[model samples]
Target: MKPVAILYDDIFLKHDLGPGHPECPARLQAITESLNDLRQDERYIWVDPPEASPDDIARVHSPQYVDWIRQNCEAGGSVYPALEGNLVPETYPAALKAAGAVIQACDKVWDGEWGGAFALVRPPGHHAVKSSAMGFCVFNNIAVAAQWLVDKKKAASVLIVDFDVHHGNGTQDAFYSDGKVAYFSTHQWPHYPGTGSKREDGEGNGIGANLNVPLRAGDGDDEILSAFNDRLKPWTEERKPEFLLISAGFDAHEDDPLSEIRVTTDGYRQMANVLKEIADDHCMGRWVITLEGGYNMKALGDSSRAFLEGIVG
Candidate 1:
């Protein structure tokens, strides 16, 4: 079996918002510790991620917006009101690497250098739009990678599956009208950023390409899995994606403080299995997963480990 690449670096720890910020460096630390045993396993390989160039990011974001973030970070960092967080000097570099990791993972998996890749990055991106950051996200990492696949790699079609507790408003907005990419999300509705209603499906050429299944506050693994098995399965069969990208957010875990969803470690495992099967059947097993939101330390760690186990198994 080919090794699964794990993209990570210490710079991620430096993109700190503050002492009490929920998206803290410790989150990555906890996840790394949980997967410590995998360090010696031949099936997995950890690699440092390269920074994304301005042009790579500009593929998804406007050039002006990209310059704005760099300028702000260089000028001693201040509060980014839109992002709802502080942008320290290190934030810019970390954000670049976060997006770059996903790009690299896409390249590796697409090239068959790895069976799959997981980008363990920070400043969790799912809320960032094209022009501005939001909900603590600096750049839409998954969106950037998705665009890269289409614009540079020339992948005819790609599938992006987001299972975060909150809607990936940024990602959806990126490919909402583009038929080359399909965005499917299962998130808690009437929540933060508030944009994942089923009625907000795609427009124009992308009319049926976007699928949103908004779950109620207390919905758990059963509801989420059903959405994947029923709604997403058929949707994917039609798309027949050339590559797969997952916005893997574990915050929906019952133990997480951020949301009311009750997905367990086993739930994530099952979800990964389903996703992997879809990739195998449609994409020739070409897939990449990038970390998104998962606040509870233990839950994030355990759930991530389980998800990876399911994928690599």
Candidate 2:
């Protein structure tokens, strides 16, 4: 079997939010510690990705917004109210590496150099919009990668599947009016960011290209798995995407402090299995998974390990 690439960099650890923020560097530390055993396994390979160029990021973000972020980071790191985090000098470069990691993962998988790849990055993106950062994310890493696949790689169609507990408002907004990319998300409704309603389908050329399954606060593994099997499966079969991208978030884990959803580690495994089958059937197994959110360190580590195991199997 072809190995899966694990894209990571120590620079990610330098993107510190604050002294006592939820999105801290320890999130990656916990994940690395949990997956330490995988380093000895031939099925996985670790890679250090290059920083994303300005043009590369411009695919999803406006030049003005990008410049604003860079200027702020350079000027002693001010806090953007929407981002809800304190940005240090390292934040901009770390965000660049984060997006670049996802782009590299897509290239490696699309070139058949690897069957799949997981971009272990932070700060978690999915919440960053085109104009500005929000919800502790600097750049919309997965959105940038999806656009890269469509624009640079010339992929006919790309699909983004986000299972984050919070709606991927940034991702949906990125492709809401574009037909070449499809966005699907299963998130908790009446939650943070307050988007992702069933009635908020795509518009214009992107009609029917966006799908959202908003679960309740107490919803658990059964609800999420059913959404994947019943909703996402049929939607994917019709789209038959050329490339698949996953916004993998473990905050839905039962032990997670951020949300009430009760997804367990095994739940993530099952979801990964389903997503892998979809990719294998339609995309020739061309897919990349990028980290999004999971506040509970132990839950994040364990759930990520389980998901990778399922994907590799």
Candidate 3:
């Protein structure tokens, strides 16, 4: 399988949160450098993430929110993850492209050009809501992409797996009542933006479509892998999703300071391999992932390489 296209653009380099913030611009540089250092293989198709139009973003976001972000793009100030109330105004075009990169990734993955794709864009996007921006995110990238596949691509089933240390509340909120997409997440409960509870299965027709596996703080690879076997795999296999999207976050790594989940670098590879196998079996090998969080530079670089290696296979 050809490595899923990675929508890359240097413009994502300028999304500065502020001095010494954990979610710094340097993270992307590390990922890019590591990817470049690897030998060229048949699996990769590098493509610049073209800007996503306002209409594309509107698929999952409120129009007013999109316009507000455009107005605030260059409005720079204090950085977030706020120890104090520091308001850092998001730069306009940077947020647009970051969200856009994922949009393009959605298009590519749905078209079946590559087996799947990963968007290494930043100001990582899992935390942003439909009308509010928080947690260093300006747009809900994965949610928008999921909607595109359902609305534009005419997909009847979509599966989204979020492995971020923090619950993907934004993504959940977007699809809370919709059964067209399946949302599964494994995250640290009682963490930041605190939402994903084991009881949040879904509502109405989407009742069982949303699955939450709230891992305790400090759970390591064995625990996560068990959760995958006991929960995600069985559920996803039965659902037989037509398209799959991943909210790939490396913050669970032991080296990362953000949360207490202790997933190692090797665990990341194992999980990627498993996820890829699932996609191949169910979705005709159509899976797309977008970066969410991984603060420690070394951890992000290592984990990203492992993920790419699995994708290229």
Candidate 4:
């Protein structure tokens, strides 16, 4: 197996939410610090990506929303009321880079240059919608990457597996009507954003394509992993996606202040391993993952590193 490609840049650290913000720059710093050994090792390759163009973002976001963010940042605005995120002056460029980093991860994995790739980005994107930003998310990074693949004809179908503690309402909204992209998520129910019910599956042509397995707050490894084995695995086998993507978030860790889920370090690895199996079996091992929400710095670093280990193994 080839080494996993890591997409990162210092610019990601510049997307400061604000002082004492939970989604502050320290999250990335913690991840970087924890993964320092792996980064230096020959098994992992780190790549700095270019800023995503407005055209790139337009693939998934509405033109009007994109313009709003740009203008908002240029005018020295610091807070985005829609998402409740502090949008500093440098946030505009940082968000662009974040989207671009995920795109580059997809490009590398699609090209078979790496078995898998992870975009350790800030301003976590799973909560951002097509026309609005929410929950500390600016632009929906994973959505843009998947849509880009569809637009370029690089993939006929894509599978998005979001294992975040909170539901990826934004990613689901992006592909709700498109059968070409199957959105599957396992999130805490009755949580933030108040979405992700199993009944809220995709509409129109995508009715059966979206799968949401909403777990309870205290659901841990046994409960969460069983959901994957019983539902996600069989569903992926039926769909046989051409590519795989993950909205990887570690906020479910027991120590995280955001949620009450009790997933351990090993639990993250187990989930990643299952997803890796699905990718290997159906997608020729083409996988791209992007960071989302994970507030507990120590747990975030440990769990994310474990996820990488599961992927590379």
Candidate 5:
């Protein structure tokens, strides 16, 4: 089996979220440093990702929104008042690179060149909508990759699993009417963005394609893992997706200050193991994981390592 490819670079750390922001560069730095020892092993491969092409990013985002981001970045200031996230000139390029990492991971995995790929990037996506950026996300990386797969006829159906503490409202909205992409998420109820109600299964043809497992603020490993095993597993079985994408986030960990969902590092491992089994059974082990939200530096590094170990071990 080929080694799991990790798409990473220092450039990702350059998309500054500004001082005192929870989504800071130190998060990635912690993860990178924790995985440093693993880099010496042949089972893992680290490679820098190229910048995402604007045309490809347009796959899931509006052209006008894309241009607006460029203007915002070029203007050299933060984007959207109240968002609190900075958007320096380098932000646009960094966002492209972050998104591009996922695209390249998909390409490499689809080409049978890797067992799987993990895009360890910043300016974390998933909250980015088609028309605008939100929640510290500048671009919807996983969404764009899923759209690209469908556009290229690479996969008839995709399974997007979001383990973020917050609901991926942007991703859910992007594919709410498209049956080709089935989004399953486990998040803290009444959390940030406030959008992943169980009632919001899907819309139109995509009805029944979306599943949301909203946990209480203090929900922990057993509760969260049960949702994965009982709900997400069955959903994937029914859909039998041709590709698997994970919006991997560690903010749900017990130590993370961002949310109250108390999932442990072991919980992340168990979740990844289940997802890996699904991929092995349905998609020939083709899986792509991208960073999302993880605030506690310690938990982020530990849980991330556990998740990767589950996938590639």
Candidate 6:
């Protein structure tokens, strides 16, 4: 098997939103640079992401929302960041390509053409709703990719896991009513956008399909590990999903300016290892992770490199 597929380009890093934005252009630069510096792995292949067509997006989003995004992108100016149910301009295409990369990685992994893949693109998609962009996301990339795997590829049940410091409300929203997918999230509760409450279980036939593990402000490695072993792992073992999609974000690192979770770069390694084993045992070693958040440059770079190293392991 070749090393993980990396979907990235300098252009993907060039969509700037000016200074003081936590979601800076340098975040993408940090990921690309970290991937370039890895010496232990030589099998990683880098590829530029193409724009996902409207049909590809319609799998999880409404055609009207898709049309709105195109209009915003065409109008072009600093638009309000998309989150949950609203999409601003300027963030449209960026979100689209970010979602495209995850879909591309999914196609690769499901085809058995690769062991795994990492989508290093950004303007992270976890907060974006199917019909609206939220939390700086215009499209729910991870959710869309999972939907395609379930509907088009006929996956028995796809597991979507998000470890971003912020909860993946948008990803959860897409699958909350669909029983064919499971959404598991570990995020700081009472944080930004603030929607991953434990009581927000799945709706209708999707009851028990959604699981939210909200970490306290100071919770760190030990607590995360406890949650994984005591709750996440046991539940996942019974579900035995055919594929796993990770919303990989390193903002939980102690040094990040983002919300406090006190996790270290090593925390990412540990989490990646756990997911890798789960995927291997229950999902034929298939997994695709996409970037979410990690504002501090050093933490972002270090944790990302650590994650790729674990993938290679």
Comparing 2 with 5 on TM-score, the higher-scoring candidate is 2
Residue pairs in collision within model 3: 3-43, 73-90, 73-91, 73-92
Clashes of 5: 0
**Candidate 1: how many backbone clashes?**
0
Q: Give a tens-digit lDDT track for model 3, residues 1-313.
A: 5555777787777767666778787899889988884437556778888777888888888999787666554465443342222334535566677778877887777787666788988767777888877787777888888888888889999999999999998898888889989899989888987899999989987889999998898799998888777899999878889887899999999999999999998888888888888888888888888999999999999998887776556
Superposed by TM-score, candidate 4 places the C-alpha of residue 202 at a distance from the truth, in angstroms, of 1.1
The lowest-lDDT stretch of 10 consecutive residues in candidate 5 is 77-86
Q: Give the clashing residue pairs of candidate 5, or none.
A: none
**Model 4 lDDT, full chain set:** 0.89
Best by lDDT: 1
User: Model 2: what TM-score?
Assistant: 0.99
Clashes of each: 0, 0, 4, 1, 0, 7
- Please give, for residues 96-209, the per-residue lDDT of candidate 4 as tens digits: 999999988888788888878889998789889888898889899999999988887558789999988999999999999999999999889999989999998888989889
- TM-score of every prediction relative to native: 0.99, 0.99, 0.93, 0.98, 0.98, 0.93
Error of 6 at 56 (Å): 1.6
Cα-based RMSD of the predictions, in order?
0.7, 0.8, 2.2, 1.1, 1.1, 2.3
Residues 1-313 of candidate 2 have per-residue lDDT tens digits of 8889999999999998887889889999999999999899998899999989877888989989988888888998986678887888988899999999999999889989998999999877899988889998989999999999988789989999999899999999999989889999998998998999988789998999999999999999999999999999999999989889999999999999989999999999999999989998999988899999999999999999999899877
- As a TM-score, model 6 comes out at 0.93
Report the C-alpha displacement of residue 79, candidate 5, in angstroms: 5.0
Residue 271, candidate 3: Cα error in Å is: 0.5
Per residue, candidate 1 scores C-alpha lDDT tens digits across 1-313 of 8899999999999998876989899999999999889889989999999999989988788889999999999998998788777899999899999999999999999999999999999988899988998897988999999999998889999999999999999999998999899999999888987899999889998899899999998999899999999999999999899899999999999999999899999999999999999999999999899999999999999999999999877
Looking at model 1, which ten-residue stretch has the lowest summed lDDT? Answer: 78-87
Tens digits of per-residue lDDT for model 5, 1-313: 6989989988888888777999999999989988899889888899989988999899999999888888888888664643466788888898999999999999889888988998999888899998888898989999998998888755889999999999999899999999999999999999898999999999898999999999998899999989988998888889999889999989999999989889989999998899899999899999999999999998999999999998775
